[model samples]
Target: MVKDLYPSRVNETSQIVRRQDPVIHNENARTEGPLSAEEIDFYEENGYILLKSFFQGEELQKLKQELDSTMEDHQHKEGPDIIKEPSSNEIRSIFEVHKDKSYFENLSKDERLVSIMEQILGSQVYINQSRINFKPGFKGKEFYWHSDFETWHVEDGMPRMRALSCSIVLTDNYEYNGPLMLVPGSHKWYVQTAGETPDNNFESSLQKQEVGVPDEDSMRWLVDQAGGRIDRATGPAGSVLLFESNTMHGSAGNISPYPRSNVFFVYNSIENKLEQPFSGKEPRPEFLANRENIQPIQPVSNKSTARS
Candidate 1:
């Protein structure tokens, strides 16, 4: 069974759910825009870029509300581990929580999300998968360094294709709160390891070692091979991190007292054909559902805020 990260919050069993609005940014706001050459260069060189307040405050609040409500219901059926309180153990596999039609409907109508995605991947980009990562204060464990593309693909034999995973922070993320650590430009060095399988093996290694220190030199070697380029993605709520499918990244453990949550949406390019179905479940039944939902993403806006 997956461990509960926030025992206090879940055990109390209060129905009170917090609600807030999505914060809209005034910086270069536009419904649709093409990515500039320099912005593309940054992604090519850095493997990932942090987009500030990508979702409005209200939208984020609504999603959070849905997550909380679903998690509350999940606790009753799946045990106390499902609705962990702040400073509890990490909870895993939250997909089973409240798979309601309204949840899918709300996600489908997220205009800003859809608009930004369309700009980055063209109009053909589709939603392949959606997941919520709930990490409670001090109880949340570290997510080991790796790439998403290394795990997901068409079940049938086929050539590897590019994909994208978009992560939106629902709470403030700092080093102590388990901010994401990325190896810049590592996407270009992606090489399929012969007979290697994707699983928690990598995470196990991370759990046994200290943060910023890898037990195996191979991890260091990989980053060094990428010209020693690395960066820790830390930001407040609403920050969005978009990375290529092959980008090497990981996160530290949450040592803070505040809970951390991030909702991930994976997308693919429509031009790249899949040999078989990408997900085990049927399509989302929404118009936006498509095969290209998890493919590598192109930037829609040429203008990018300078990294602070």
Candidate 2:
């Protein structure tokens, strides 16, 4: 079934990757409920929302464990020096390693996450893509300011509409830790630049110098052009930032001692189709798999019965 999706791209010898179950068993943790009406309004208006303490305690620890294991697995096989330090160039292209069942299961089964996504993007959301971002200390690359959806549409021929992204901070994030930065409410303008590019360049330019590093003044000017509403998003471990794909955003290089890692899940309405496969290798099997396994948000039935 997976092979059929890639008419000309499939490698016959490539191993079949198993899909993860969409349920996680964490006895010590409780699920966080739906977002308040105010929270939903904030997301709709500003194009992003920082849910404080979104994941913590045991569940957070479990995710960290999984992240660590995944990192270690990659490091052992690829060698420690695969990523050198003190550069802000991020190591992109890590999907093969992220295809593990545990990673997908952990992300998909988060009840609170699904509830919040449903509230923001409706009940029939489809995960467009998922990948792990590893930003090594000092050596991590600086991601320039741009909209995720704009780059997607340009490169993959996808349309720009109703796209959403959820970034789960697997490690502690602060200004020095390469936390994501954004221009608040920039999604409303739908700005596009001539030479803007996506940050998915890992092997070729991952460690290369930024082609055009925007100076502070230039960055401020760009923010002003986008309406002068800029903000840096930083939070505790397990914090998640949900934003529209068109939100203008970027991240700095990690200046801290430790590497900053995060997992990004991009979702769009199921009816939306990608112009090309996310990885450019083959179509995601999950996109064609059983939709029942992927939980949909429960609809709100009665306003009168709703709790104040």
Candidate 3:
């Protein structure tokens, strides 16, 4: 059995656990992809990198079209994958996007993205999870601060921190639009939150997470460790934010008139395939944590017809 390096949701009191893995797996190697040595170093020191204008013009429009189609296709359908806002009917998120075998699947396989994943992870990677988050104006709910690795480790059986999330901006993400906020350098430490895993936690956690989150004290310490700096990932449409899996991040409720949306893809190294849940419960549904049909994606050329 693989040792659980980071444990959460098993204690009455929350504590900090130092990360045992490297943020950048292969720092010495020369990167053949888009990211430079300095960029890799930045991601190592901090937890995320916001690449502005990563996709613009026609390439970006295509993604937007796909996003629209996805929302429309599943607007009325009821399932665990389609999460709605707490107080409103607006769709909050659409999970298992890559499995849809549509434009999103192609986006996941694009060589530009896959190559970067391979570079940072230092191995072939597979889609651990994929989703599109929607935060409509005024009614969108806030996602509380928590490290994704914490939930994935305790609930979904992810074994290590060799994973990262890529958020492709589908709409303008202004500061007032509830853009993602991440604490710099917090990814180096894992926050073991207070709580025992309840049965079918994903059902409720998907809409509003109450468990597997850091306490106020833990959040304060993490912010102090980063010199009390929290970064708001604000950018125009077509920007991309790549963040570490263990990064402490969250977003506020959107009160602005503008809506915020983004496509999220989680890439996990093949070496870090999930096992039995560390929380001693059944694993989350495949839509949330994929266990079967897992295969490393090949890097292919960008297929968008219109060039930026």
Candidate 4:
């Protein structure tokens, strides 16, 4: 699974919760522009919704430039944020964008995103973390099936799953490029796969334990019973995907000629701010678990952009 994501607080146990909920989308809501009421409802019901071609052109180009330059500048550097693939040595992901450059600073405060945050989360919210995931063309790695809320809850001291994440596509996300895949409506069911908590932070803990993956039998049962479906989030270079933190998501290794790249912004409701990490591990880097700069965003008033 992607390292920079939020994990669930699936406690020490082995149980697959069977939550029976039927989802029906409302086709009457406005189907254009930013999220409509019906669209938001769909997200609430299914755990995620892809906004096709939500961004484009210059904005995407600038993000690409910032990502490329940052990667180039940090080549060979060793740290938690600059993670590299084990086999190909390609950069798997770059973490904490709001720390490294101003280009990513405006992402959280953009009206386009923040307004929707207000609608789904509430009037008060702040960014939890940010990162750019790179699934390289030929050697992109696989992110095994797991739930993000389990990590945030158990490791990061997040009390509940009040946060959500958005993936802003920078490069075309195709099936062969290992686009993200998720089990439909799996957010409501949590599986406590193992009986141990991570000894350390989320990223390092992933190396130490399986974290939150359910047993194979349970997964098969959930896929068939929990709406019996999986979705591949594929779209053009400017698409945006908003997903609940607890959702089950994973991706296969990209052995294709095209690479998949996307910038992620995780927003947590101010009402659900994090407490100190409960895991007896050392404190996570600020980039991973932000605590210092907790300010309610002023997006609508700012009309912000990267250039501004």
Tens-digit lDDT string for candidate 1 (1-308) = 22211111112121211111111111232334444445555765676778877655566676678667766556545442133333443344354221245563345335555555555554455555565667778667777776555344312111243446778787887767778889886665533332222222223332332222222454676678767866887887878888876677888777789888777776655543344323222322222223333443332321121111
Q: Candidate 3 — which pairs collide?
A: none
Q: Which candidate wins on TM-score?
A: 3
RMSD of each: 13.7, 11.7, 1.5, 5.2
- TM-score against truth, every candidate: 0.65, 0.67, 0.96, 0.84
lDDT of 4 by residue, 1-308 (tens): 12322333445556765433222122332443257777877787778999888777677777788778877777788887777766656676788886553667666677788766666664467888888877668766677887776676666666666778889988888777889998887877766566556554466643333655667876787688566788999999889999887788888888899988888899888866777655545656777777786888777432334436
TM-score of 1: 0.65
Poorly placed runs, candidate 3 (over 4 Å)? 303-308
Worst lDDT run of 10 residues, candidate 2, spans: 19-28
lDDT string for model 3 (152-252, tens) is 89998899899999999989888888889999999999988997889998888887788998999999999999999999999989999999999999999
Query: Which residue runs of candidate 2 sit more than 4 Å off their true CA positions?
Result: 1-33, 76-93, 96-98, 195-222, 225-227, 276-308
Quantify all predictions' global Cα lDDT against the true fold. Answer: 0.52, 0.54, 0.88, 0.71
Q: 3 or 4: which has the higher lDDT?
A: 3
Error of 1 at 257 (Å): 1.3
Candidate 4 residue-wise lDDT at 132: 83
Give the deviation of candidate 1 from the true structure as CA RMSD.
Answer: 13.7
Q: Highest lDDT: which candidate?
A: 3
